[model samples]
Structures are given as structure tokens and as C-alpha cells.
Target chain A: MKLSREEVVHIAALARMSMSEAEIEKAREQLAVILENFEILKEVDTTNVPPTAQSINLQSVMREDIPGESLPAEKVLANAPDREGDLFKLRPVLE
Target chain B: MTDKYTDLTIHSAHELLKAKKLSSVELTRYYLDRIGKIDQAVRAVVTVTGDLALRQAEKADKLIAGGKDGPLTGVPVLIKDNMCIDGIRTTCSSKMLENFIPPYNATVVEKLNNAGAVIVGKANMDEFAMGSSTENSAFFTTHNPWDLSRVPGGSSGGSAAGVAACEAVYALGSDTGGSIRQPAGFCSVTGLKPTYGRVSRYGLVAFASSLDQIGPLTKDVLDSALVMNVISGQDPKDSTSVPETVPDFTKGLNGDLKGMKIGIPKEYFVEGMQPEVDAAVKEAIRKLEELGAKVEWGVSLPHTRHALAVYYIIAPSEASANLARYDGSKYGFSYQDTNNMWEGMEKTKQLGFGPEVKRRIMLGTYALSSGYYDAYYLKAQKVRTLIRREFNQAFEKYDALVTPTSPTIPFKIGEKADNPLQMYLSDICTLPVNIAGIPAISIPAGFAKNLPIGMQVIGKPFAEETIFKISYAYQQVTDWHKKTPKL
Candidate 1:
């Protein structure tokens, strides 16, 4: 259950977050404590239990096909920190 | 009139509205004035929608005058910022979304409005509902109205504090873990986390989808029931919303609970629990016994020790997936590029999300990644099932289970901030209900060292009516819910 510094770095990269060396060290220690505490699950017998993903046992409820009034383009873009004409602009992602 | 409205319960307010003694506009303005005067020091509301609320109040007043007054007509309600209110800024208390005004109303918001409730303002929360304390909010930490130096419990701290402070009649808060109940406990209010899928999650900015549920934080159990009646229903917009009939929640508030079997699990009285919290919970249990309910010490839920671990894994795993939609291009904050799309997402999310949020996303991504799903995510789900089965079996004999809502009383603001594991333990007793998808409520049980403590009443799935009945009965007998935090 021990989480290594490399594992923290790997998890951070997978999650698409940039972290500093200090954060990695802090995460490693914190994650280890959490993982160790989680080890108590090993004592429980879960052989016959079916995993419950949701509390309500209901299937998808779909709405009928219908058109509705949509917000104006300006209204939609009102909160954008950076935007172009009808589109949200962002920093380039490719190398 | 000011004091009358200030201390009035939702039931009393509804009566006043029907009798034409109080106009919705006046009630809304009263709250707005209160917020304007007191919130500068309390810091509960992130953004006050006074003008929009007045417009809604006018509409409610017209409805009341026209004899179409609903149960919640003229009731001014504060909503957590994470719940979407179309055209109102739904910041989730994060800098990235500080300016974001949702384009559409969340299903709950629409339902509340349709029920003739007026929106007071958006209350602050832990940024995207991440932390146990309001300190995580990027805007400002909402102070405990009772003790300004202490926190009011969090994620939904502002909602709980606002209701506690009488800034609003009732407030809606989403509980992912203990966000709703913990804050309610700290502020001495009634807060419920409905059965999963009971309330629509369409416009609630995703935190942990499976564990998240929107419910009410109110002054009393009756108001909680009334608010629950308005908000609980199926919606086609949310795929997971159940199509079951919304029960008349208030009808069963006076239902008899005599001879009901209440279970007290031994696991909840774990080591490290504050002596004050333990004493307060015991006192509440004794009161329940005095009300003619049969109490028994239950031995079920042996896997309770693993709840926090299981919750951390599963909640963060779902959170990672749910938060993936906020990549800056579609909504909220986006950084300007010197590179390409991948760099853009990295820069935006990196700069936008707080440290705790980033930590969870990373943990979740690892758990759900190709190789680790079985070991982490899938294993956690299996453990979750075991936990649910424990409750199911226990409920077959017990009418409801009782436990302390939190192990310790509300800690100082920065006490557990640096230690994530210590912070996670705050939800130990509360997380089982969320993981099991049962209806649970926290009511002010008593006080410890001048701070309020809460006792959690957990019931089987779809048993909110019974839970409320028990809670109402308890509130009627005890004055714990009436003990207000003096600001």
C-alpha cells in the first residue's frame, strides 16, 4: 500500500496536473497514510456481495426529442475568461 | 416583524403567505437587507442576487394574490454556488469559474423556482466542493456566525451558516461526502442527504457523481421535509434520475415512531472520538429511547473501518472522470497558448484547479487507468457492495441506524488542512450512507464545549419519509435544533 514518489509523479502526469517537487513529496507521504488506512478492507469477506454502483436501481430515463430555446451566443460566452467569435479560446496544446 | 421573520420556520412563513400577512417581495427584501447588513462580517454569500430575487419575489407575490400559492411560495432560499442557476454566477468558489454564469438552470433550481421559492443568493463552498472546510474556497472563507474565528464546517459552509444566521429561510446544499451534514452540525441546523438519484444532478457541477446528492439545510425538520418535497423528483435531463413518484414528504412528519427499532453500531464509537461528541450522541440516543423507540446495539457493518478508504478511492475515481469536461475550452478558465491543444489543457487545468482538487484528480486517474482499474477502482466497488449489504441486513430488523455524524467537533480552520488523511476521517460515519445510497440526515443533537454536535439518522433506500418522521419526533421532544449560535 506504500505509494512511492515516482508513483505520485506518474499519477499526477496521468491526471494532467503539473506539480512541483515539494507537492510530489507531500503527496507521497499523504497517499501512503491513506493507502495504509485503506488496508482494513483486506479483513472483510466480500465473496457473495454484488458491487452497488448506485443507490437507486433505475435505468436511464431519456427525454423525448424536442427543440428548446437556447441562450444567445453572447450570453453563452459571457463568462469565458478567453473567447473568440462564438468559441472559447485556449492555450495551444500541441508541441 | 424583523425578529418574527428572522426566527420564522418555513412552515410559519408558508402560513403567513397564505394569510396575506407577509408578501413574498417583503420577505425577500428582508433577507436581502439582512445579508447586506450582516454578511459583510459573516461572509456567507459569494454573490447576492438581490435584484433578480426581487423580481422572482414579485412573481411569487402575484401567485399568492391569485390564490395559486404553493407550499413554498414567497420563501427565499439560498443555493450553494455549485448548483447552476441560469444567468446567475455559479462559481463553485473557484477562481477558474469566478465569472461563469450558467446558461441553464439545474433541474433542482427549476423545480424550486416552479414551487414558488425565491432565490436569495449563491452561497460559497469549498472550491468545486472539494474540501471539508470552507477554507478551500478561492473567494474567501465563510466565517462561523457564532464564533468568527472558527470555521462553520464546509463545502456547504455558507449554505449552513446562512440558514443558521437567518439570512435565508432555507438553503439547498449538495453533499458529496459530509459537505451538507457536517456544516449543518457545526451551525446547528437540519441537513439531509437524500437517497442517490432522489434529487436531479443535471446542473450540479460534478464533484463525485455517484456519491453526490443535493438536499436541504433548514432551521427545522419540518422545513427540511418541505424543501425535500419540492426538490425530490425524476428528471429526464439527468440519465440517472429515478422515475419514481415523489412522495408527499411533509405528510409523514407527524407519523408515530413508537416501538420503532433503532440500531446503534459499535463501530461508530471508535477510538479518537472526542469525549464531547460521544456524550452528545449518547444523550440524543437516550432521548430517542424516551420517545418510546426500542434501541438495540447492532453488530452489522463490520467492514465500517474501510469506509473512508473505499470512499476516497471511489469518489476521487468518479471525480476524475466527471471533472474531465472542464478542460477550459468548453467552459471556465483557459490559458492563452504559446504551444498546442495538449499544452493548453495542461496549462489551463494546472493553473485553474486548486492543490487538493489536483491531488484527487491525479489519484482518481491512476485508479481508473488501464492497469490499475481492477486493483484499485474495481476492488473499491466490491468493498462498497459489502458495506451496502451490511446496512441492508441491519435495516431488515432495525427501523433506522443512529450514529455520530462526525468523530470530532469542528476543528480550527487550519488544524487539518495540511493533512489530507486526517481531513478525510471527518466523514467516517457520514460516508457509509453515501456509499450505500441510503437516505441520511444530521440534526443538532447537543453541544460540546459550547460548539454544537450532530447525530446522524440513517435509513434504508427511499425511506426518507420515515427518517424525517423520526427526526421530527426527536426535534419535538428536544430543544437541540432550537439552540441557535449567537452571532
Candidate 2:
């Protein structure tokens, strides 16, 4: 049930988290214990059971396509860590 | 003991306000003073909106003067930090949003404001509501009001502690897995997780969309019901919030349980639970029977054993997706030292989240990864269906189910903090109710070893009134809830 170091780094990357060597090892050990416990679900007979993504039935929530008041540009940009004229300023997308 | 404003329940305060015996301003100031003096030890309150509360209290007084006051008018209430209030910092007890302020108020906040509730700032919580103990908070661990050395149970620990210490008249808490009820039990206060979709999630920060719910931690069940009446209803903002009618939750507190059916599922009283926890909940169930409930013991929910696995998988999967919004460019903490945007995003996520948060994200990513989807995520969902069905079938024969809110009394701060599985096991008794999307309430059943034990009363979906009825009747006959921590 032990998770390999490479597997831990792989999943952390997929989760958009950068981990140091120590963090990777700690996460690997902890996740191995947690994921090992997930083995319990295999005992349940879910042969014919359909997956339930939602407990209550869902329907398309429709709203009129009419224009309505929305948050002002200043308000939306207020929390931006770095912004340039109502747009979030991120570093170059490509190196 | 001195008679103080902090000791008043919402109902009693409402009466005083209506009769002009207690001014809203006076009441708000008294609570502010108490929190100012006491919250330092408990660490329950994160932000104290003394000015905003005073302003809101003044407005509420105006409404009362004009004969426009409702039950919650002028009531000082604390919100779990995850819920947004315009111009206030909504941290979710995470460093990612340490300075993040919301542009708008959450739907429940708006509802409370509309009902003239005085906003008393925010309460602490586990980081992103991830862990069972508030020790996961990046800021500081919220100490249990009853015993300062132990944890307050979380991620609603601060909310429960606030009410237990009489800091707020009542406080709002959010539950995904036993977050609200567990802490409520630990603090010896009343807590309720309304049916999923019963209350809107519009402005509340999302943790796990399907499992997360907004509820109240109050001094008593009647106060919880009073708050629910104001906050429960349909909201057009959150699509998941069902279009259902909200009942006057306080109307069912007639102390009547005659002919109502209650089920005691043996699966909940598991091995290794504290013997006193089992005994206290058993005594509460006997009280239910005495109140004329047709109590049926030895009931079985065979699929109950697998709930923890299903919940860990499903909740984290939803959380990984829900939390992807915090990439640092738009809002929340951002890491900008790197020239490459992707590197910046990754570093921001790495530094912003705590260890528990990172662990969940990793678990989620692995479960949804390409080759493993069907084995972990999909299989968990299928088992979720079985667990939900088991509860659905049990409800067909019973109006409610009774169980201990937590498996043991509140543990020391670091007892299970590092061991993730042991912390997860603490919530075993209360997890299935969330997986099934039903309503449940935890009330003060008794004290063991000088610590409080909570008995969970669970009801069918949208059957909060039945839950209130059962717990309220028990409260009538028992004096356990009447005993608050002498902080």
C-alpha cells in the first residue's frame, strides 16, 4: 500500500502544486495510508449500482438571457494580486 | 452568576427587543465586550466587526421602532469565515485567502441581513474545511471552551466555541463531513446541518459542492430553529439550492413525539468507541422512546461500513475542482516571482495551502487521474449510491435515526493531528448522513469525564421540522443543554 515517490510527485503536479523533496515524502506516506483505507469500498457489492454524482436530481437551471447588473469592473479587479487596467497581470504564459 | 446579555437566547432576546426592554445597541455592545474579553483564550473569533455590528444594530433598532422587527432582528451572529460578507475578509482559515476580501455577501449573509441580524464578524475554521480539528487552521488552534487544552472540533470549531462561550447569540457553521455537528458536540452546543440544497450556497466558499451545507451552532435548539427560519429558503443565485418550501422551524418545538418512529442503527455504535459516548446516546434514545416515539433498536444499514471511503473520494474530487479557481492571478494569495505563469500558479498553490489541504488535493488528483478514474472515483460514487439507498430505505420505516455525534470526547490538541486516518475515524458516526444528503442535528446529551457528549438526531431530506421536534422534546425533558461551559 505504500505509494512510490514518483507517484506522489506525479499527482502533485496534476494538482498544480509544487512540492519539495521532504513534502513529497510526507505526502507519499500519508496518502498511502489514506488510499489504503479506500480499499474498504471494494468489499461493497456495487455490481449493479449506478454511480451517484449528485444525491438530488438535477435539471438545467435556466435564466432569461437578458442583461442584468453585474459586479463593477473596479470591484472585480479589487482583489487582483497584480492587475493592468481591469485584467489580471500574470507572468508570460510561455517561457 | 450575573445575568448578562450574552446569556440570552434568540427567542428571549427577541421578546426583550419587542418589549423595548433591551436595546439592540446595548445588546450588541455587551456581546462585543464579552468577545473582546474572552475570545483571546478560546480563539473562536477571527475578526470582530465591532463597528459594522454597531451600525447594523442601529439599523435593526430602527426597524424595531417602526414595528418591523422579525425574530432575528438586532441579533448578534457570527458567520463561519468561509462565507463572504462584502468588504470583509473571507479567509476560510487558509493563508491562500488570508487577505482576500469579497465584493459581495453570501446568500445566507444577505438573508440574515434582511432579517435584521447584526453581523458580529467571522469565526475560525480548519483550512478550507479540510480537517476534523481546528488545529488545521493556519492561524491558531481554537481551544475547546469546556477544556482549553483540548481541540474544539472543526472546521466549525470556532463557531461552536463562540456559542458555547456566549460570545455570539448564535453562529453559522458549514458541514461537509461532520464539521458542524462534531464541533457542536465537542463544545456542548446545539448544531444543525440542514438538508443539502435546503439553504443556498451562493456566497459561501465551496469546499465540496454536493456534500457541503450551511447550518447553525446555537445555545439551544430553538435558537438554531429560529436562525434556520431566516436562512433556509430557495435562492436563484445557487443552482444547486433546491426550489423547496421552508417551514417555520420553531413551530415544531411543541415537545411532541407521540407515534413518531425512531431507528437506532447498530452500525453507528462501532467497536473502539468510548463506552461513555455509547451510554450517553443510548440514554437519549431512551428519552425519545419515553416521549412516545416507536423506537426500534438493532436496525441495520449494511452499507454503512464503507461511507468513509466513499466520502473521502467524492468530497476531495469535488474539492480539487472547486479549489482550482485559486491560481493566484484573479484573487487570493498569488506567487509572482516566477517568469512562467504555470510555475507561478503551481508555487502559489503549493505555498498557499496547508499540509492537509495538499493531501486532499493529491488524493483527488490521483483518484481522477487517467487510468485510475474507474477504480477509485467511479467506484466510490457507486458505493455512495448504495449508502444513500440504505438510508433512504431506513427512513421509509422511521421518521428519524439517532446516533452519537462523535465516537469519542474531544481529544488533546495534537493527539490525532498528525495521523490523518485517526482524525478521520473521529467523524465515522456522523459521515453517512452527509453522504446521503439528509438533515441532522446534534444536541447536548450529557457529559462524560467532565467533557460533553452530543447525540445526533437525523431526519429525512427536507424534514428539518421532524429533527427539531425530536431534539426539542428531548431538550424539554433533559437538562444537559441547559449547562453551558463556565468560561
Please report the candidate that would top TM-score against the real structure. Answer: 2
Candidate 1 per-residue lDDT, tens place, B337-398, comes to: 54566666767787888877877887788778888787777778999888888899999999
Error of 1 at B142 (Å): 1.6
> Looking at candidate 2, what is the lDDT of residue B44?
94
- Determine which window of 10 residues in candidate 2 chain B has minimal summed lDDT: B1-10
RMSD of model 1, in Å? 2.1
Per residue, candidate 2 scores C-alpha lDDT tens digits across B1-487 of 2337656889999999999998999999889988888888999988899999999999999999999999999999999999999999899999999998899999999999999999887999999998888999999999998999999999999999999888888999999999999999999999999999999999889999999999999888898899998899888788888889888888878998998999999999999999999999998899899999999999999888899999999989999999888899899999978788888889999999999888888888889999989999999999888888889999899999999999999999999988999999999988898999999999999999889999999999999999999999999999888787777
Candidate 1 residue pairs that clash? A91-B337, A92-B340, A92-B341, A93-B340, A93-B341, A93-B342, A93-B343, A94-B340, A94-B341
Q: Can you tell me which runs of candidate 1 are displaced by over 4 Å?
A: A1-5, A60-71, A80-84, A88-95, B1-4
List all candidate RMSDs to the true structure. Answer: 2.1, 1.1
